[model samples]
Target: MEKSNANPSIECTVTECEYHCQDQQYCSLDSIRVGTHEQNPTQKSCTDCESFELKKSY
Candidate 1:
């Protein structure tokens, strides 16, 4: 899918995400859910984008 507007405030590089802007490093959604897998998150890697949805292949 082609996205017309990229949420400039949310910069994303995960192309596999359905909400990611195809042509730019940005997310199409205005807001995203953020979560952590570790009980005590200490770094950025511990956090995850809970809103990420894998793009469907046709």
Candidate 2:
């Protein structure tokens, strides 16, 4: 999947975190897994992400 050059126009509260989507659909940040936050299943907020890493395009 390629990184999206198309701006999602969405701003995430996780300021220090970098995020990229796979095929421009799903966030591909390997630093944290999606299902890890079982307590807050509906919580998509990345503000609490401690291991967030940015994805670079080649």
Candidate 3:
């Protein structure tokens, strides 16, 4: 498997989106998956994320 950047800023969301924030900040977790909203129909909407105004987590 390809190694991902350990930097928290690189990941803007959580692995399971139930904890997603308005600013895009997420809690620390083992791993995360990314895809286009179209690909993952259940993906959280980050258009107006509050995390943008708050803080970012890895």
Give, for candidate 3, the lowest lDDT window spanning 10 residues. 47-56
Cα lDDT computed for each candidate against the true fold: 0.89, 0.43, 0.40
TM-score of each: 0.89, 0.24, 0.23
lDDT of 3 by residue, 1-58 (tens): 1123243554555443333433545433344444443543653563333323222244
> Which structure among the candidates has the greatest lDDT?
1
Clashes of each: 0, 0, 7
Cα lDDT tens digits, model 2, 1-58, are: 3334424553334433346544454343433443344654555553345455654432
Candidate 1 structure quality by residue, lDDT tens digits, 1-58: 4465799999999999888887999999978899999999999999999999898751
Which runs in model 2 stand beyond 4 Å of their true positions? 1-6, 20-33, 39-51, 54-58
> What order do you get sorting by lDDT, best first?
1, 2, 3
Model 3 deviation from native, Cα RMSD in Å: 10.6
Instruction: Score candidate 3 by TM-score against the native.
Output: 0.23
Tell me the TM-score of model 1: 0.89
Candidate with better TM-score, 1 vs 3: 1
